[model samples]
Target: MNVRWHNGPMRLLAPLRSGATYRGWVWLILGGALMMPFMLVGAIVYNWFHPEAGFEGALHPAVFAAVIPLTAAVSLLLPDREVERTAARRLLGAEFASPADDGTWNSRWRTGCWFTLHAVVGGALSGVTLGLVPFCAYLLIQGARAVLDMAPTGAYVGWLPDWGLLTGPGLLLALVYLVAAAAAGMRALAPGLLGQGAADRLAASRAETARLAARNRIARELHDSVGHALSVVVVQSEAASRLIEADPVFAARAMAAVGETARGALAELDAVIGALREDRDDARGPQKDLADLASLAAESGVEVDLRVTGDLASVGRLTSREAYRIVQEALTNVLRHADEPRASVLVDAGEEVAVAVASPAARRPRPRPGGRGLIGIAERAAVLGGTAEADWTAPTAAAPGTWTVRVALPKGTA
Candidate 1:
């Protein structure tokens, strides 16, 4: 604990600054020692004198504790604030190029603890060991200083600080007192600063996990239930269209299939909604992947052209899921924003599977799904370590002016 305590200021003052080392910590503690004596002494003495001064002492320690760390803090804010920057960066997996508003406590509280640790240890050493040096030497040198200071004129001879074993030992004892005080003071001031940061990181993790689970559950339930029902309903409807002229009995069967499919979909949706009654942490969504997309498009009356090169069984869930989303989003874009009522989709799954959607441009469709689709595309690409691009293109004679959406997913989501 003591070593850990000292390291905080070490990190702040003279931390390893990237390729360089910062030895500013010694300066931070020593300088703080020299400057804070007045405030610390006054606070200590006042507390010793008055009962009401307890709160004053409490606030005073932060002020005193802040000084050394503050100096170190300035060094960090300097053109070379790189060491502490790297430490926090690694802790949070943050970017140095971007602003680090997150490591506030990492820099502040940890640093303050270090300064206090140094002061306490240094003061004790000064009192117990260094203090004895002067005391031991005092029998020889104690009275010598006054004698040396004695002037030819008796004016200076009358008044002088005692240069004796008495004063040396007293100063040493005072140093010891200050060290103990500093340690206790730091404990009072710096606890939970790091804990708070850790809590924030944990909260973010929990939140992200919860969000992911919720979204996955919704998606899986929709596909397994609503999506399957839609598939059955569409098939039955098509059968009815063909058979209505030939046989009313077969037509009735087709219409009944629609009702049963829709009911089944609703039942699945309800089952998912019921799962929310369990602990949120217990929620689990069955994994869905790219193998399911072709069926999804077909069920929705959208034509798809899928081409696979490399085996996808080697591909993991995260990559496969992201690729599925890319296809889903692309098709959504074509349905809602494409210039033509019909669109073409081609997915190539080699080392990379590229999904591109193409539609004629002259048939102006309603302006739609700009913000949400783009954000979802970017998010999917980011999650999969892939990328997506969309553009409006000038048409060739064979394929007149058209709009195209393309997404590329790598085998490895690095």
Candidate 2:
């Protein structure tokens, strides 16, 4: 372990937990500054009681001191409760090592209790050094009385060891405090941290499993179920248009049926999106696959010419989603920047999936230093475990020169 060396006395001092929350600071300050008077008053009252030894005879304010910790304890305690832990799990997007289906309300409650105890102990220890010192009050009085020889503290100058008698105890308390604060800080942030180490693997698994399930579900909804209905509606609409030229009654009926069909599909799409938005504790995932790309393209009102020659089902969801994202971002760029009326998206699936989005020449192209857009494309591809290229000019004169983004990712990104 490489211990950092700081020059001077700061090395002897304890470090505060760097990640303390806004609420944590509020509790600390209020407990220290606002509650500080009690410690001063207790030292004063204790001296009055002891009379002879004066200020040194003072002890801590046990009552007020107890409340300072107790209040902080209660606040920190509630945040780590079973209910709160569940919320934390969802918010932080981390998984704890408990049996998913086996977890009970009591299980989280028990964890919360442990967390609260540790947090309160830590918070209270921190409050002690900051609040109980009475160092600030002593300084103000001493500074005010420094010019007067008759000052009560003037005759008290004597030989002392190592920055006075407070060093050992003060340092010991500080060490205890730092340990407590670190523990509490870890407890507060642990769920998020625990999963970070293995997030990529977890995500790959979830995406593979979730995507297959989502794709199958969406396919069933879109293909045999919704697709068949839409086909019938289209057929009926075309038939109605012909009927209108023949019989007025039949034309009106067909157009009404087409409208009803479209309205029903829209409602069903909303229901699907809603189900996905639900908070599920056991949310493995609803996976996305390349199979959904066709529907996605259609839904976006972007004209697509899809030609898939190989088994797309063999590829994993993680790879598929990354490919999808590449396509999505490319299309978004065209829509936002290209201002082109039409764009072409091409997908070549084999051992790897290659996705390319080509946009028409910008009427007044945005100033790009390296023949542009290529750098951003390459960076995004690298993140998704792939390579990319962009060109402002076409490879052959047969094809019009335009901006193009092409990316390739591994097929087994599970």
Compare the candidates by lDDT and give the number of the best one. 1
> Tens digits of per-residue lDDT for model 1 on 184-285?
343344333222355556666788999886776566445534554665576668878999989989798768767765765676566667665553534544
Q: Give the TM-score (vs. native) of candidate 1.
A: 0.41
297, model 2: CA deviation in Å?
Answer: 3.1
Model 1 misplaced stretches (Cα beyond 4 Å): 1-285, 363-371
- Per-residue alpha-carbon lDDT of model 2 for 1-414, expressed as tens digits? 134455433544433423333234443343344334444655676667677855562344364444444444343434324444453344323345432321434333444443444334434545554554554344344544443433436333432212334443455455445554544554466454232224445656787998776654444334322443465466667778888978888788767766775765666555455555653524433444678777645543334555555677777777776566566556545644665435788888887888888778744356655332344446546755789876687435576558877788777744
Worst ten-residue run, lDDT, model 1? 18-27
lDDT values of the candidates?
0.54, 0.53
Clash pairs, candidate 2, are: 210-286, 210-287, 211-287, 211-288
- Provide the RMSD of all predictions against the true structure, rounded to 1 decimal: 17.5, 15.0
Off by over 4 Å in 2: 1-278, 281-287, 362-364, 367-380, 394-398
